[model samples]
Target: MVQGVDSVRQLFFGRDDAENDLTDGLLSSAVFRPNYAYREVLSGRKSLIIGRKGSGKSAICRRLAAPDGHPGACVLITPDDAAGDEIRRFELQGVTADTAKSLIWRYVLAVHAARHLALHVRAAHGRRSSRAVGALRAFLRANGESDDARLYDRLRRGARGLQSANLSLKAFGIEAALGVNGASEGARASRQLEVLEDGVADAFASLGCAKTHPPLLYLVDQLEQVWTVDADSHALVTGLLLAAKHITGRYGRAVRTALFIRADIYDTLNFSDVDKFHSDEIRITWSHDGLRDVALARARASLGAELTAEQLWGRVFPPSVRGEPTAEYLFGRALPRPRDAIQFLNACRSVADERGGPVITEEDVLAATERFSRWKLQDLAKEYLVNHPFLRALFAMFENSGYFVTREVIETRFEVRRQALHENFPAYTDSLTPEGVIHVLYEAGFLGVWRGGDVVYAGGIQAPPGPGEDEFHVHPCFRPALNSLGTERMTVQQGALLRSDVDGACERLRRLLDRAPLPAPTHTETLGEVLSIETEALRRKTQGRPPTSAQLRNVATHFQTLADTLRQSGHVSHPVTRRLLDEARSLTRTAGGAIGSGQGSNSEG
Candidate 1:
């Protein structure tokens, strides 16, 4: 049966097992492996995990912390949760909670102490008899504390010890003791904080069997949440990450820490000092192919199906590939981000459930696509164009052009306006141009490029080509807004025909006629001259037949319409003189009878 059925609750619910364990679960489970990311972490490298929310960052963290066959190989910790616990347990030699805030140095020192303690515990194997443990005890005593001190006593607890103390920490109300103010006073406080951090690292080292085994791997998750809290929390989290980098670099043989962070927050944290953080430490992105494999593997696991990525794609979206499906086919025009693909499948599963079956059909997938497209567009509209007026105008123009505007068409409209009113406009009109507006729309996944050109529909925009492509298009949803803008600038007819009125057309024609400098007619002018030229040409074709009166009237009427249009639009420079002379002569020549034999045709005919 499909996972999510009966209720919307089930539809959105994800499997907890898939989240915690990597084997035999969701298709997404197999699709997402921490080994690649883990390898980087295990090598003492630092990197960023940039998937959107729910894209498996947390799952990857959990998996890395518990690699198969190496269950006791790594430590995973969240600073937000463990900070207060670490501080209180690693307070400076002469510090108390009241003066902890002043002892920033102790905090750093405590980290070292903590590291030493953790190493000691790992060496002792819970026996407290080894030389490392003895040396650590002596170090603690000499630095500030006595042998058999409570903190050292607790530090020796190890993984099982810490887990068992979970309730005790809660009962004693020491969980909140991990707060910033819990460390000791003065420069020693900095020392204490460092010691505390070191302790935590050492604890992790101990759990991962780092002392006698390979380097310990610790996965730090949810760094973004640090920024959401108060300033002190933010600083604490940043400090920890820096400390991890430092410790790993200085002690590569002993431990490694990999931090999984959101892409959006990576820059904000500003950990770019590669000399301090190491340039080789950062890994920021997962390629499209990598994400595709992740999605396919997860789907197979979730459905309990033994299928290759290709076969799995076929089962999920048979119509997309027809005979044999692939990840590219299943995702349609959308890029193969693991989260996007999984969410799509989830949406399809909802439709299938509503249809009373575990099976998802092509129709369901299409419906899901439509739903995602509309949702994506709404988000893009709000996020990108809600405030900028110029973008608003640009969007309006794009929409008016029926959503498939070429660069030339947009440039022409802008140029015409600029020439008419903004003659002093800057030269970089195209650079200051609103192409970015389209780009923003594209990035948000609302717009996509089509084969013929880019196209945005109710479903979403088609993907655009790389730079230097000939054509582009957009979604039709922009049509209404653009048409409205175009209507305001000039009437639809004016903009469409590139003329303000019939007068404008006539003025254009007059300009062309004047530029050619044709001779005026002997009695009338160019209008009559043109009519005579046409009549004579017709006569020549008809063996010297003259034009009929009916034909003459039709030709005259056409010219009069043109003159009237020109006059109305102020295109006729000498309208009154031209009208009086032309109208009178035309009336004086009114026909009284047929110009030819009853059965005869006119010369023009």
Candidate 2:
């Protein structure tokens, strides 16, 4: 029955285009919205590309990795790339967090410098080639890599034995065999590392790398994986920034390094020589038009159809029927991110499919509200969990259906709940100041004005300096779900208050909340699920899909609705039974789809 629809569905959805995942590889024909990042990063002139999660960090990284994505062929080092995991493994090893950051960066620069030499020597292909190759070979051998292995494999593994490289190698092998400790050992290690860097530089000269494919462009991404405000995490991050600053000092022009990073992480870290990292840094900003343009590109790719996002959307969901797209309408429930718009559409598509529908209707989008909320909550958990483990529960107080509220409400709520929340989630233990919470929420787009415009905050909800609304609007994206929970609780309160028993109402509300206790997430055994959730408290974090209780209730409600439809049509006996039996068979046969195998990036870095 659904055979022909499969092709159209495939076209309609296009590629996965997930914000958190990566594409298979660089594609010359991949749809990319031409922007300054392409030019700057390709030129090897920009060292840092900063943006929010859905802002195309990975997209740009993918482009640079493509053969033609940049003027010079690029070497990609993504956060998930296993070959490059060693650089980050420093912290996992005995390296203290405080010192790991710097060491990691230094190691990264040296390793890449060595890689450039390897690429150049191999490219040259002659006697000078062997000499040039030998220099890099010394580096690899010194670093513990097996020299006999194939060249391509070693390119990514780096020289594993770097730690003991210069440690007076057995001028006392006897002392080493005896496990004798040397007080001067640390200095020897440092000197050897420095010496290795010089060797890589010399190899660069020997390869005549300047004549090789322009300077090699080295792209570094996802530093936040190891980043933190702690001294050790900070040191590692600072070392990376220092590498960007002193690029010419070691590799000179043989290699150009670019890092795609989260701006918030960068700003929060305490690093030295900031100007060097900042000098060539470019922040990816989007205009309404800009976002629309990118959205169209993705939509086109997904649909495999010829029209822009606006044209396609208009054809499918015309403004005459749906009204013009307002920021609050298109992005009302989203974070004004292009990726969010795409995902929202995907969520709508998922709902519409069950209706045997071809065109996406307004009802479809609206019906996706709960699922969309879960998606955003999943995102919030993934992005902020490492920093704030109790994110969702901490914000439960503000879930009051106040779309607009005075600042006093926020302050009072925090004042009442701060101590209790702090005790549970230590991320904010030292930061319970109401103002801090306010700033954090605002900066992260959790709270904002009712609408975007100039106005006054007659109440204590002070408007930002120059232009903006005074009213606070729980962001349409996430507030609704939280508010929905509150509304359900309100029903319980209303019944208790009907008897003029105010105390009874208060007691009822307390009991209701006790039952809810912040919607603890159950355990997720899958790694993909783990990757999407970042908090230390994984079992309590939001899941990819909304809570199952809501889903089961929804299913029961749907069955009742179907029975009503069957009665209205007078077809309950045969058609209804047949449909119900088929569904039951399908679920039982498929094992509820959980047993299914299969399958499964991005503006956001």
Candidate 3:
């Protein structure tokens, strides 16, 4: 039986979040697309997976921890708020803040490795454990690392151990205090951590785990839950990077570490060693094809049927949305990532279900677009809230403006709000300048720079907007929420040709709707739908080709209807209203006449 809208909505798309999606949801082994980033991590070549929020970092992390995941046992560490507080407050007197944090992380990793080794050595390598393995068990038991305590509790214990240099190293045969009495606190702490790590390494070596078994994988994820925009947070992340690198080399092939970090948080690190991890950094970016593949896979997984992409997209969902292929329209407007795609696809289905549909119609997708845009806009701000707390406040600068803007326009907009922004966020005034705001917005993917005939956003190896790049376009993902749909400022000459006059008329009507007040919701809705249809038809107009006589006539009919609707609304006879009415009626007559004479005219009367 063909799946109905209710089933498609309820079953076809999984939960928006991968965490929830993995448990009794659709993000199973069947639907998870093992993209480049996942492959890099799985191969142990990339330990730092950076991506924008909802870019599938956690999904990869969780997938690695699944039973069918990595060849080796996986330890997933997701710090909660309590654990974050402990790390943020941790400081050592004789070491840098980053070093102190690294030591703590090393302790955590070493303990996790030790625990894994103790169990593996007995379970797989036989119950007759080696002396080194026995020592790890003793050490874990003595220091309470053996308990299945929460991450916060473990961090608290490790923090206390490192702060006091009192980690029971007796298991490694050092029953008494260290002889380095005159050393700084940092040296003492480092020496103690080294002892524990050495013990863990010894166990790995003794059991030949490095040679006989796949490396134990440590997957640290969801640091954004604990992240803040402060010196401590910076140190916290920098420390983890250093620690992950350290243990990867220190434990040799016996252990591997991967940290799935949000790009916004990762980009904020500025320590001297930040550049060293370039080789290990794999940024997650989803292509249109990749997203489509994901959508198809998820749909198939949900239906438990071998549904082809065409059936899922063309049959289950409308074939096209607003004159573009449904897939293109959907993914193009979303930040290219799994989470955004999932949320949007599911939202369309939900809307369709509510409207009592067997399939997701164009109306459902259009309605979902606005809601999704609002969600993404708010999410974009929240995604960078730790680093760019003023992000939400900056949205007002783009709201109701054209989606396409030159650097000059943005600067002018920022200039008007610069003082207020500085006053509101004095700590961030340095980044509140026009140039600074542009760069920030560009990095956050809220804006894309026009370069080399394409709108390039962040990720995908695209360079940041340079000083010479004057043109910028608000990302489609955010345009609807900002009500900035007009593309008047776009450099259309760089693309295929467009019918300038009809396009202009459409733009004029949009501007009129934005400026002039209508009588009621009914009129506004009717006019909005008409304009939307006209825009879609225009989008379908072939590139580099003039509108045919039939197309012109169709447009003329739309304009005539628009003119009549405006007249009936009885809008105030203001300049904007009069110009809109005049433009619509004139275009109707001119286009209609051109078609009647079997000639096409792409001009306003």
Best by lDDT: 3
What global local distance difference test value does model 1 have? Answer: 0.43
Give per-model TM-scores: 0.49, 0.66, 0.80
15: Cα error in model 2, Å: 6.0
Pick the winner on TM-score between candidates 2 and 3: 3
- Ranking the candidates on lDDT from highest down gives 3, 2, 1
lDDT of 1 by residue, 1-605 (tens): 22332222233323433343444333232444554655554454444444433445666676665545233345555544344344333333453432332233223323344444545564645544444334344434434433333432333332122222221122112333232443333343343334444444444444444556665555667654434423344344455555555566444455555667653344334434425544544433345476666555555545554546544445444436334343454454343344555555666668767776545667676566556555443434543331222333344345434443444454555554454222332432443343543454454443444333224322212344445432344542232333422433333332333212222323433455555433354223545544554544344334422223333344435445545444454545554325423542352244222222111222121
What's the distance in Å from true for residue 358, model 1? 6.4
Clashes of each: 80, 11, 0
Which consecutive 10 residues in model 3 have the weakest lDDT in total?
594-603
Error of 2 at 580 (Å): 72
Instruction: Evaluate residue 359 in candidate 1 and report its C-alpha lDDT on the 0 to 100 scale.
Output: 52
- lDDT, model 2: 0.52
Q: Of 2 and 3, which scores higher on lDDT? A: 3
- Better TM-score candidate (1, 2): 2
